[model samples]
Target: MGSTPRRSPRRRWASLLGATALAVTAGGALACPAGAAGTNVDFATHCIPPAVAGIPPIDGTTTANVSVDNTSPKVGDTVTVTYTVVTAAAGNPTDLALPADIMTPTGKVTLGGAQTGAVTVAGPKKNTPVPGKGAFPSFSMTGTFTVTSPGAITLSPGDYNIHTSYILELDTPCTVITPPAPVSETVTATSGTPTNTRSISLSSASGNPGDSVTVSGSDFTPGATVTLAGRSGDTQTADTATATVNAQGTFSGALTVNEPTTTGIVAYEGSAWNADLGAGPATYVVNDTTPVPDGSQKLTATVKAGTLSMSQAGDAVALSAVDFGQGGAATGALRTVTVKDFRGGPAGWSLTGKVTDFTGPGAKIGAGKLSWTPVCVTEAGSPSTCAAGSAGIVGVSGATLASTPDGTLTGGEFTVDAGLSLDVPAFTPPGSYSGVLTLTLT
Candidate 1:
């Protein structure tokens, strides 16, 4: 009796039909939609939540958490709001939007009630998902919302809602939200005092004649004029500041100490403005003189007349005159002279010469003059010519001369004559005579 295989055939068929119906209801009900149960499309509502459009969050921020004062701000009172946004999904939302409202919790939002501007977002976007668990995209945003109001408006401190939303087109379910990553930044302007530190130096402390000294300094104004104190005698101003100093703060100027003395030069930062930088002192020296002659004096003498007589019967007879010319003198004093006969030409005949001195006391002779003497001579022969004799015979000597001023006579004259014969000899060689002339101060 195994329970009589016990089922009726109809009973077995009914049981099979009920089980098939239950399976069909369970599978077909969930499969009826575009996506199967527990699939990505099944949670589409979660992935694409209702968009909360409002003011945008700050860049690089994961969420929008801004602090705004709901006080009734005056017309000029600037009320700023800081907003932050962060991505919670593996990729950035294609179209993210933000919106804000300032009103009581129960008041309806009005477009004209608030002042707004388009939000600016900056950063890289992720178009594709990561390989494994997909990357949790992150970003930050910072924005300042200025309040435009004429009077005070009250608002209690609370979690003020800032609508933030984004879109996700990927088949896999993904969430789009601006996490609360709020940040605040305050900017202010203030003024105090400027800093000024100046210094000056001279490259060289001293210099020679025509030498230049350089002066250098720092913190100098552009187009500044420089002046050296006592060194003005040698310092020269530069034509331009750029020529003197480069952008690196180096300056150079030359000071010529032409004078033979220690001079000081003071450099001023600017001519128009008085700013004494420093001073440089320098010295210079001078030296120079004239030329003089080597040889002290020169002397020259000339014989003007002379001739030999043969008719007188014995030897030669001649008469001649001498002249002393110009001389150079330093003391401006007169010089004396004396003469003698070396060869007696005849009886009662003598050789003589005269001296004329032009250099006087305290007198300067730029060009000197000449002096001459009268002439007398005698004959020296067998029948010598006598002064007063029938056989008038004579003997004579040539002239001898000397000057008082040693080595000072430049030129002079001498004379010779025959006492009893006129034997004028022709063709005599030109005679040049020299003597040592002494020079004295008297």
Candidate 2:
């Protein structure tokens, strides 16, 4: 204009203005242009919201707390893990599709869903609704994870993030779960007592040799053995619970007291707990003896040349005699005798005859001859005169005796000497005789 303003090209004028602006903002961006220009080009940036965490609610009592052990999981080990989700911050819901993730990919991570050989993801709904205030959304899920790799995995100990955005389509953010607290429990055994008890006594304290004494005791076991000692007896085994104590306890038989003696018999019982009889042994005493004959003496008679004779003379001719002295003596005696017959037998011989008195020698009077005489003699000798010629005799006359096979007597007689004068003569027979005999006790 003043010199015609030196006219410039249009493209050259545009390039010059862009080069001047690049130089001014080379190291940094340019500040908004003054007032009206900045108002026309407004700019801003937005950030993703933080995820929330919460502990899952437990149904039952927490046993102590969840403790992480050094147990490496195997293929078929039954594993039960419990967890609690706690919300750190409150805003939008956290999608919990995959609650745990395998960082090293050593094993498959599973959640609350049906399982297969491959890795599984499970939990509450992805895009779970979260409240305005910080909320402890509780959840529990169980599944098994299998190790596909051989060695251990090197993983840092920290909260691992679960990518729920890939598994489920959701608008809410996802978060890592924290471990739970630790806990412990106890265990115990018991037993019962036993059941068991013992009975035994003597029936009688005194008994004879052949007497049976009962041993009364209860609960005697089968094949229980009982022994009775002290006396000359033997032991006894009970066939049943009850047994008879014989005189002797010897042998398997009854006890028998054979000999005559006074002894105490001890009964010993044996069982499982008790061995032999101790202080409480059952005892019994036995006593016995042979009986003695009364009012008799043992005697033996000798026959002279197969002949036996006896003479007696008294108020009544009598002889007292006895047999083997087992019973008493025989009491009456024969007066006189005449020979009827005579013989001998196995035991001895006796003579059978009749009794009569002689008035004189060889005197035959009445129906028969009086072959016997009676005599009476006293120490005082007071009666000095006889009936006719001599004094009376106080004893018996001659009597002969013999025996036969049937115990019959024959050819026996009572005889007197022709020259002998007597008042009443009494003759005593020797040895044992059971017939009868006279007695003269002055």
Candidate 3:
């Protein structure tokens, strides 16, 4: 049981207008004609050709129309390319294929149709059969094109004849189809204005430190690069942030102020597509951390002058016990007092010291037995020298002794070194004694 094999479709279909080697053996009978040259083989009842003749006689009208969704498009716009094809014939053609080619001024190819929400076309498309729709087969397809750059874009499109092998069948049940005409179209893109003009605004009219200030812009060039800058008080420019404009041509960002500086009015600026925007001098205030007085102004400050004072350098002065058996003088610890005058003004000040009698629990030692000399040491120059004084009796003249008649306070401060001596009597107290000396400033 052997079956009959058909000839090669490509080789047999190559000769559409003339006879080709496509023989059919049926019941001990050969179907091919006799001669190979100058004889046309009808494929309607013998063979299936791959394509039609290159320049076959036109038997019907075929038209192609092209259009776009947006005639005026800006950069980053997604436009649609619609192609409507019509063939005035009885029904769908036996073999039909349309290969379209498009050339753009800027040959940049955009691959992402899902991202731009447009229909993607990969290659040539075949004709679809629509029964009872019209007298002839009518088909249409739409492709997407994205405007990437700013400028005029030219689109040149044409359809290629790839189905040159398709031809009408002829013989026992012969049928013929008219060839479709070639079509092409060209377009030039133009510029269009944005939906709105470029404008910028601040989140708030005024704000304080630690608060976030939002800067927003709208109606800018779509997908354009933009940057934000600001200046506070007398400070220089500071770049805050950068963002890309969206499909709506809008962008916004927030900037936080954290430091305790630049208190005056603050202004912001921005630019996109060489256009400047966001000119605002917003008022801002940095409050002092210290609590202000009840009657003081919120923006006012006060500075107070210092005062002059005297203080003991160390703990109370300690004097050793002196036995009456020894008639020699008994010396006490060296005592020092400091006079600090922080006031910058030039003035005069007099220093004095008063002492009470040296007394124990029940015994007493007369203050006249103790005398001390005052030595003046000028630690800081007040533009004058401090006069030193001689020793004076404790109770009689030392009780309230003056520094010196000529000792004048100058440049505000000077130190005094006081030396104390106690003259014990023949039968002084048998217990420890203590006294208090008070230093005064005037």
Candidate 4:
């Protein structure tokens, strides 16, 4: 945001909230009375998204209201929290309205005190995506968190971001600008003892086959023999590991995972009977370690499609007429020819041109008398320039106008043009002569 940023309605006033607003106490920000089941906190947040595409840069403020279902939840209890936009981004009437379907908003809430982690909140899939200004959608997001430890659990409005498909590589940043004190609530809990839940964890989540994976468990009946069996898919392997639980209600030992059929998770678990006493299962990933030796096997495939061809810019071209006043030779340029090589590369291609004998009112001219100087040009995506054929009489044998090297060309388009010449016999009669020039591509 610039130093003199024009901010949103609710957000700009964050600095206005001072010690004169309320007596700073030990966090009693709830809309609920002094003692209530659930709690609510009111605050202001500001966001400034950089200019993206055609959307202008906008930094605005919005009021937020957050509430929780259980303020004094015991340890191990899951609590649901809801964060609502009390006031939409309708401030700053000058802001350009964004069209719909481009944005799907999602956000986060910061947690502190007893629990130290952020809660994920998902917003509506879409808002009013129509074109407008200063009227952002007012939405709410709900998330859950399991209470791990019991104490004064504090919740604060945190930063969030606007997600848009228009510029996926960039992110819109927001901030919690509640100036006075972060609007927060204090959670008073009853039990401090954490629940001893049956759970299993592995030291390494993934490894090659035969790698030793340490299986750890907690809260199992102390001193009981923990039988940790290894299973790949539905089949249990012969190798198994066991460890005696200490009086502290925990155990950890090594188990080797060696499944050869496929690359996937290999589960090492305690016996089902031990599951009744707080023993769970864990898994170790096996790498796809299958070796491919040289000269073992070869697979080949072929796609038979496409072609090599040429196209003329026009149907026909009329060369400049020459007067048979004691003639020797006459020359003109051929029409622009484009040759496309879509023949799946390799053996290269050839573009040849030839002409038929010209017939006039009194006599006929020999086809072998026509000659051409061909020039081949490289076009877009062409690997190399097509080689120009020699300048000589072409009607005697087809002229190799333009051709690529044996292993050089790999499917691209090239342009070609040729200078055509006619040798007029000195004693020939004066008349208008016409001939057909045919171009071929292979």
Candidate 5:
């Protein structure tokens, strides 16, 4: 399928009511006091789901309950915010089911009054299966929003987007309408203590090259431009991402890992000590991704494997001897050969065989007299293919026994078997003749 064209972001906040003021941020690691400050905000949200074929846009109210761990936080204190989507306005409205690995809800909450910054919240992915006729799953997102300074912070609902991407790109732009009050919640901050900017984190600790990561910074000067420098060990890499500090002194932006880069990052307000950041930066690990065999989703492993090889079962095969006095034909089963491909690459492999002339007591029989019927079988459930060689004499020129063509994976074990036969002539010299059979795999 071709790439899906992106639709312009829909503007829906203006028409909807106030959203449940939910603030989510990364805060636990920051130093904060044990506190008794809280806010419970409840409100309804109206959303317009993406338009798909044969399914009408779902129109309903999504109720949410939000809470902050500490409302009376001091300057530079980290407070936890939890937003529970009490229920979804609608279920999977499309005829098709949304796949399992789709990401979950992530939205922003706006603040007014004394505090004037926004908090970003995101939930986890890999949710349970939502059947074609099942209801949309309910979810809860929890994170921390850092308190930058002393003020009476008022929370309000902000414009947020949701994704369902199945037949078309899954997108739902939502707005908060008709809340109990204009402000869904409030957080009062006092000028208790001041802690300089010194904390930073990334939404994803690791990712593949060309993948993007979110950089978060707290306690920075409001409206200041924070420079995000990718760090390798103690040295800064060539790549850098930047984010502007909001009115509340918090910032977040995306950084693309163009190469296999180390984790550490330095977010600072340029050279001067405008903020305490860059004093000692924390690192973020972005490792390279490995391609799996047979289109598997095993991306976490970094494996360096060996090449293709072949082994045969049993020592040798002894065909029924021809007595010459009653000569007719000598036949037996060829030894079973196993081929293993571990080259990691998609280039396939081939197995061919040839045999030398039979020799007995200074007399010999032509290798052309030997012919075989070949058979091949791939291992059970293996995403590879093996083909039997043409039934004929395998002489010096050699013939293919089994092969997995190029452009396809030939991983795992595959067996190549053959039924061997030798045409014996009358009065032929046969004193337990033995010949070497050579099999080559590449």
Candidate 6:
């Protein structure tokens, strides 16, 4: 604060007279009139009152409070401390400079290589208030103490003192006011350490797409967020699942191997994180496979002269009477053809199927008119593109079978589900027509 310019003695007389009269009426302060040139007045004797007869002088009380960011501190962990001092006083503004120290259970603490302190004021507030000499002032001082020692550092809650070098200035004479008693607060320090080890485990060692697997763990920091992720060979994906460590330091939740995940061993990793404890990670595994939920990839080979073979899922496919009736209506049963690769090298194979014209009786149905719709099936129990087909379904020109890798041998064998349908014109002569559906694989 900048000081006001000094006024000449003659110019100060009127204001001084009025201030003296007011001070005398108030009775707390002594009254003194401005002196004449070269005639000095004993200002302290007249303006500084020994003591007020009735009203008690207003004074301030100091309080120290502390809080720690992390109650459990561990190696490599830095914690923060918030210390605040509030003084309640309603009187003339008294400027006080109070020193504060953060001490461990054993000794005092220094943050940023310096001692901390709180300066107090009078009234009911600390910051900007209605400014005037008689306005009761109240204020508070706060400091952040950072503990970077990593290990255990006890936080003393109220082990501090509010020392006052408080000074009071008046209209004529300035008198220093000192509290008769020393004010200090005794406090207890709280300390903790982080030294818990974490471990994780999976419910099972393997699973298929959409299979539910339990992820369980223990010894993690309480209330920490844990995320689970999975990786298969070169492909990585995040599980849309997470768990929070409970008060007992344990976590458990069910996560699913997302559908369409690659057929391989998927390695799962989970980690728990907290602001104070950092991160702890663990790993597990899930073997994701095909048609069979086989954790072990055991491929038993059955060799034959052919590179591919086709067979119906159940008995021979039986077409209903409408399929053979006269309206050009087509109908048949669904049959799955299992194609096995005995001739495994990397060279691809193709399947071409055709039906011979009905020849069992006097009249026949043209074989070329028959059509088949085939959907390729993958080991993952889902429909996939055939290795060598455009429409994938066979027409009059005959459709080519599709295999993975275009031509090379991928999984030893694959299955294809095909629907057989025959068309009969309404005018066509009909006998018990019988035709052989020939599916040749190369």
Best by TM-score: 5
- Candidate 1: residue 161 lDDT (0-100): 19
Tens-place lDDT digits, model 6, residues 148-219: 234333332222222211121111111212311121221122333534334444454334357776666555
- Tens-digit lDDT track for model 5 on 1-442? 1232232221110000000111112112221211222232345566675665346555566655455545666776655454555456656765677766453465555657765555555444435678876766666444445566678887654444555433344556555666432454577888855556345655543444676878877667789888877766456777677789999877888877665655445678875333345422433444334344575554222333344556656554566766666666677776677777664333456677676676666676677777789999998865567889899987657788788753323366688888887776667764656565666554
Predicted structure 4: lDDT: 0.53
lDDT of 3 at 74: 58
Better of 1 and 4 by TM-score: 4
Q: Which 10 residues in a row give candidate 1 its minimum summed lDDT?
A: 11-20
By TM-score, the better pick of 1 and 6 is 6
- lDDT for position 127 in model 4: 51
TM-score of each: 0.17, 0.16, 0.29, 0.33, 0.42, 0.27
Give candidate 3 misplaced runs (Cα > 4 Å).
1-304, 396-409
Query: What is the Cα-based TM-score of model 1?
Result: 0.17
All-Cα superposition RMSD per candidate: 60.7, 67.4, 46.6, 31.0, 26.4, 38.9
Model 5's lDDT to the true fold?
0.57
Candidate 2 accuracy as TM-score: 0.16
Candidates 3 and 6 compared by lDDT, better number? 3
Candidate 2 residue lDDT tens string, 1-442:
0121221111100000000010001112211110110001111111123323443321221111111111233322222221222222222234443332211101112121121121111232223433343232433211112222223321111121222222232222222232211111000101212121112333343344566644443333435465433332233222223243333332122344443342333334553223223111223344322333587532323221122223323223232332322423222322322211121211122222222232223231121222223332212321111111132222234233322221111123323111111122222222321111221100
Q: After superposition, how far is residue 374 of candidate 3 from its true place, in Å?
A: 1.0
> What's model 3's lDDT at 190?
44
Candidate 5 runs further than 4 Å off: 1-46, 51-57, 99-101, 164-169, 177-185, 195-225, 229-239, 242-267, 271-275, 278-442
- Candidate 3 lDDT tens digits, 236-306: 34435566678997777665654444222222234422323432222222222444567874343222224
lDDT of each: 0.24, 0.24, 0.38, 0.53, 0.57, 0.36
Candidate order by TM-score, decreasing, is 5, 4, 3, 6, 1, 2
